[model samples]
Target: MKVDLFTLVLIVFALGVCVTLVDVGTLFSTAEATVTDETEITSARE
Candidate 1:
C-alpha cells in the first residue's frame, strides 16, 4: 500500500467540491419552489 499526502488531499478536495455543488443545487431548487408557491398564492388572491 503506497499513498502520498497529495493523493489524499486531492481525494478530500474532490469530495468537498461534490458536496458543495449538491448543497447549492438543493438551495436553488428550494428557492424556486418557494417562488412558485408565492406566485400561486398571488394568483389565488386575485
Candidate 2:
C-alpha cells in the first residue's frame, strides 16, 4: 500500500493538534490546583 503526501501530512497535523490539546488540558488543571493552593495559604495566614 502506498500513501500520498497529503494524507501523510493530514495525519501528522491531526496528531500534533491532539498533543497540543492534551498539553493545554494539563496546564489548565495544574493552574487550577496552584491557584487553589495559593488561596488556601493566603486565607490561612489571615
Candidate 3:
C-alpha cells in the first residue's frame, strides 16, 4: 500500500491542531489556579 501526500498533510494538520488545543486548555487552568491562590494570600494578610 502507498500513501499519498495530501493524506499525510491532512493527518499532520489534525495532530497539530489537537496539540495546540490541549496546550491552551492547560495554560488556562494554570492561570485560573494562580489567580485564586493570589486572592487567598492577599485576603489572608488583611
Q: In candidate 3, which residue ranges exceed 4 Å CA deviation?
A: none
Error of 1 at 13 (Å): 0.3
Q: Which residue pairs clash within candidate 3?
A: none
Give the range where candidate 3 is weakest over 10 consecutive residues by summed lDDT. 1-10
Question: Candidate 1: TM-score?
Answer: 0.93
**Residue-level lDDT tens digits of model 3 in 1-46:** 8889999999999999999999999999999999999999999999
Q: Compute the lDDT for candidate 2.
A: 1.00
* Cα distance off (Å), candidate 2, residue 11: 0.3
TM-score of 3: 0.90
In terms of lDDT, the poorest run of 10 residues in model 1 is 1-10
What is the model-wide C-alpha lDDT for candidate 1? 0.99
TM-score of each: 0.93, 0.96, 0.90
The top-ranked prediction according to lDDT is 2
Tell me how candidate 3 scores on lDDT.
0.99
Model 1, 1-46: lDDT tens per residue? 9989999999999999999999999999999999999999999999
User: Higher TM-score: candidate 1 or 3?
Assistant: 1
The sequence of per-residue lDDT tens digits that candidate 2 reaches over residues 1-46 is 9999999999999999999999999999999999999999999999
What's model 2's TM-score?
A: 0.96
- For model 1, name the residue pairs that clash: none
Better of 1 and 3 by lDDT: 1
